[model samples]
Target: MKIPSEMSERIKELAEAISEAERVRVITHIDADGLSSAGIICSILHKEEKQFSVKAIKQLDKDNISELFSNMRSDLLILTDLGSGQADKLPKNKGVCIIDHHQPVSSEILQLNPHFFGIDGSREVSSSGLCYLVAREMGYRDLSPLAIVGAVGDNQDSRGELLGLNKEILKEAEKEGLVIVEKDIRIFGRQTRPLFKALEYTTNPYLPGISGSERGAIEFLEEIGVPLKRGDKWVRLVDLTEEEKKKVLTGLVMRIVKTGGSVESAKVLVGEVYTFPAEKGMLRDAKEYSTLLNACGRRGFPGVGIAVAMGDRNENLRKAESILDEYRREVSEAIELLQKEGLKEKGILKYFLAGDRIRDTVIGTVTSMLMGRREEVLVGMANSENGKVKVSARTTRELTNKGVNLGIALRRAAESVGGDGGGHSVAAGAKIPRGREMDLIEFLEKEIERQVNEIDG
Candidate 1:
């Protein structure tokens, strides 16, 4: 892959920094994209024999930033997936290099994100794509597959095509013969992986209907009694077979026209079921890595996820998988509890789970899943390790059409209550001083109502 001329200078500078620095620290978001970005960097550093440590953060707060700079004591810091929004809080030292694709919030960090340079930063291109660009800039073309996997894990491949640097990376992967893109014929129903395993691994299993759960994925082969082994589990899609694959022109289609569809509806509406074959085996598949990584981020062990992505085998992968499954079960149980309690629907769908079991990591997935079920935006709040109330918000593009920017609203609301928050238009998050959770929620409700009324009026 040829490096873009525009980014050549920046990439050269970054490579020099990596080469010259004795100790380096890499921090990234904890989601699949972030983990993948970190993995790519890690792989490069590993190949170059550069000493480095990686940290996966859920949200970049003041304390974490301070601690990172204070504890790492490194000559260089490379931040990925995150740090675009918290540019102001970034270390003042000149040794930091940020590679990201999220929408830039301020002019100070605008130069750091490639999207500001006319690159697409939506699902079409992700942080991994940005990381790939950085790697290409550094002259490591072999690591492009890491970027592709990260993009896929981030759901950037959902459109069935790649755009921007994502496409460039895919082409590179194809040239390397690392990825094979063939037209898929079989119609796998909603679930694709082991339902129990996916639930255990997902941040919000309840929204699998909308977000697409591999566990319940239906497939033509499974429908015909062909047993498929995916990972360590057995899966069969009851509605698909080789004959059905020949008959069906496309994969199964699920639609969620409105919010609050059945879990089944959610599954069908959001994702396409297909079969994926790798050297390990051929099996039914779905996109669940986003939710899985979100769960890991919310739980404060994003490094484990990065390790898993790096192809960690044996005990480490199993341990990470166990932790993920346990977290998923807890979140599922919490959602069930919320439904059973029948909490009144405010302007936003919300549920509060008390006790230390609830982590800041799961809030984004839980809230996003809840919002996916309703027309209005959804917000989920939980207690964090620092005794602060962590809040997560998710809004659809439809809501954004009404001029609803949950990121701005939530950030202002959180700040008003003596907390800090910010995020994208569709999804955002914040951390508030403990005991101000309700106040923050009330403020968000008022702001959302005002925005809706203004648009309607």
Candidate 2:
């Protein structure tokens, strides 16, 4: 892979920083991207024989930042998948290195972000990819698979293609025989679970009348003559004959269109699918690998995600799989409730207030899932561990193109209420005090209105 001149210069600077640091403290987000970032950095440090410790957090607060800097135990303070936008909050006295791709809040700190070079952080590349660049420069090309997992985890390949630096990382991964890119059905569970269950749980294209309903999916499969089982063994998607798959896919598309779904949505049924032939368990599929890591992150066991990312396949893998099941159940139930209750209309946004019912860590995932279904923007609110509220905001691609930036809006809003927030323009989140939930909504509503009105006016 030919490194662009600008990127090569930046990588050299980052390498210099890494070379200077002896003992390091890595603080990362408790999501798949963050987990992948931590794993990659840890591997690099371990190989280089450097001392380091890691902490995966959901959000950075005063207490968290204080703990990070106040401890004189480590010299280098590294924030991965975070601190790009919260630059002002990061302690200047400490040697801070931010490896992130979010829309950055201006600062003078040493940071490696794609957004600075006119790259789309949300879709083009993820924090894991940026981390991979530094690793590649350091001569650790074997971690490309973990970078792929991180990109998939952040939905950087959500539109059926990996863009910009993500595509480059995939190419390197292919060269290393770490990943195989193929054109196939984009649905989940193609290799692991049974076909009916796969169809039932898929929420990406979101097949109507089948998804989220076990009996509906089963009945539809039977009605279409797609056999669920052969004798005693259940049939998975990988096990299906070409003819059987054709019949099932045709029936599903027809049903979805009959339910008034768009033809464009149906057209997106098949796209580039990523596979890992040598990987065991759910990690074989990039999307499932992401879900497994997410299960650990959102369930307050980011150590498990890092452990799995670092190739621990013993009890840690077993526990991560169990956590994935629990995470799925919670998300399924929460989405169902949101669908039934519907979102509250406010200005150009549609918001759902989950309050204390949903977990704070999973609110962003839920909000993103709710996007593009009768809403210009989706806001998910949950009660935080402290007396604060967690806020997750998501905007449609249509709205994003229409000049909406939730990152700036949420960051400004959260800061106004003595909180902090910022991320990609499309998907961003914040943590605000308990009584400031309504303030956040009002501020966000006004900010979104300001953007839309600026374009319209």
Predicted model with the maximum lDDT: 2
Colliding pairs, model 2: none
Per-residue lDDT of 347 in model 2: 74
lDDT of 1 by residue, 287-355 (tens): 443444445565677877777556565554666656756666666666655555644456664545444
TM-score, model 2 to reference: 0.94
Best candidate per TM-score, number?
2
Clashes of 2: 0
State the lDDT of candidate 2 residue by residue for 189-288, as single tens digits: 8888888888876765667667677898899988988889999999898888889878877887788678655554565567677888888767899888
Question: By summed lDDT, which 10 consecutive residues of candidate 1 come out lowest?
Answer: 275-284
Off by over 4 Å in 2: 205-213, 250-269, 373-375
Residue 67 alpha-carbon offset, candidate 2, angstroms = 2.4
